[model samples]
Target: MTEERNSLKEFFNYLRHHDLKMETVPLKEQKDYQHPDDDVDFHAYRILLLIFICGILKPTFFDNFTIYGRGKFSFYDFLIRYPFYLEKALRIKNKEDKIKDLEIKHYETEEAFSPMIRYIRGPWDHKYPDILNYMVSKNLITVHYSYFNKSQKAFCITLTDLGLETAQKIQTEEPIWTKRMEAINAIFRKDAQNQTIEMFVREHFSTLILGNAGE
Candidate 1:
């Protein structure tokens, strides 16, 4: 545990050198920096959240949190995984003076996009656009929709140079987000038992996992 903690710290420090440590930056200031067409409600915190997840899982400015691909990459994956990671990363003590485990270990399974599609936002409630759609609209990402084989169409998500620059800006983001990233990495590292709630999510949304191009 000690070694793992040290390495996580070291990795964070590594990003700090590139100005990824925003422990001193205010949230409002971060909010002030965003694309014009991007919705303030979504961009204020949510976009950065997405970027951070993408950064950690792929660990490269070049890789994207893909929507449809040949690998374990998609917004659906985040929806399913974030809750689990959050529960694992956060620990709370109970009245018994003993630690009560918060992780439910199993989430009631749903299709990956179920939550997002059903998510109601703000006073003028509407289904949020596909996050990738918003990203592309804001010029933060470049996407290619093409068929990988005869029957499989796929969309590959990659960062634009501008997107890459913005990602760098987000690297040194607010402190709470920084800790979340650390916790996420820890959770990902500790899943050595091959335990994942993603199986059903993946199966239910096989189109995403299988790169279902619109036929």
Candidate 2:
């Protein structure tokens, strides 16, 4: 267990050194970091958005928490709202208020997913196929497919050990470790998917590099 913990610490250090730390607070709180402009932030935002979506789909620490947002998946808002708000800010859209309103409705009213998934700049960035292709190219995941499409309004993909390893590499350095041991204990103790996911989420904002619950 100690060795495993050390390995994860090393991975987090590597990612932080490479400036690839993907959490919201760390990015914003970095002293030397300059705010990214439109195009750059868009790509970054897309990546975080994917992580957030995948995080929510899993059973997480926030599953039982109540969210005050008035959105489509607001029931899932405990997991959804922060990511949506983060994306909205990163986009620097002039229609901020309108966007918020729509996001609320986006999850609430649509039996199917909102069309915004298509807002990805490239077709390759829109759904699961694209994610799988990227992961394969980067050696984070592997799959065989000629084409990809949405299913039940969610993308279907598989995770590799590499991906799982990658997720465990990230570390939390904010608000101290006051609540983390509790969160981690909950994570390891829970056999239930929904309960475990909510626990996993309390410590990490969005990194689904870990295994999926339902799969």
Candidate 3:
């Protein structure tokens, strides 16, 4: 009976030491794993949100004061994506000065232009069909395609009345985004009136767009 008691005591001692050590071990931080589809959906929703803001800004219609071509639409999408650049551009009073400042800053450092550089090179046009189709299905926007020939094709997009109303409602609900959109529109509206916003974007980002054309 004494031997058995000692054996039990040793077992308890072993467990006490091992269990306490195990309890003291720190746990590694767990990373949040997002699915690939989640990223796609995130960008899709971002595009939709930007389009909604466009409805409020009215810069979505830059062609003939009623519609905008796909290239022009893509340009606006780029601006909406990187609003930091837009906000900075707004600080400069003159349009030419804004373009020059942006270009200089973009070339100043690789980090400054890396994200914008990557976006300019990305397959943004490939994602357009899916987003535009979904918006059309929701009656938020309409797309018009004109194909005269391989080199003479044109694609236009315009927001629906429902889209504009929904955008206004979103602005009412989200004051932070509303202020950002208003600031963005302040810069875009000027060039949009002259139907030169796309040209402005091209000029503002010539180094990124034109310089990286081969890539």
Residue 8, candidate 3: alpha-carbon lDDT: 94
User: Model 3 reaches what TM-score against the true structure?
Assistant: 0.52
Q: State TM-scores per candidate.
A: 0.39, 0.25, 0.52
- Candidate 2 TM-score versus the reference: 0.25
Candidate 1, residues 170-201, lDDT tens digits: the string is 65664444444444444443211112324433
In each prediction, how many residue pairs overlap at the backbone (N, C-alpha, C within less than 3 A)?
Answer: 5, 12, 0
Q: Across residues 1-215, which tens digit of lDDT does each residue of candidate 2 receive? A: 99999999999999989989565656657666453322333232233322222332232322211111111112122222233533332234233433433333445433322222211111112333454355566654433321222321212233345544443342232211212222222223222233333443333432322333231
| Per-candidate alpha-carbon RMSD to the true structure | 19.8, 21.5, 10.3
- Candidate with top TM-score is 3
Error of 3 at 126 (Å): 3.2
Candidate 1 clashes between residue pairs 3 or more apart in a chain or in different chains: 20-171, 20-172, 21-172, 22-172, 153-213
The local distance difference test score of each candidate is 0.42, 0.33, 0.51
In model 1, state the lDDT of residue 182. 44
Give the candidate order by descending lDDT.
3, 1, 2
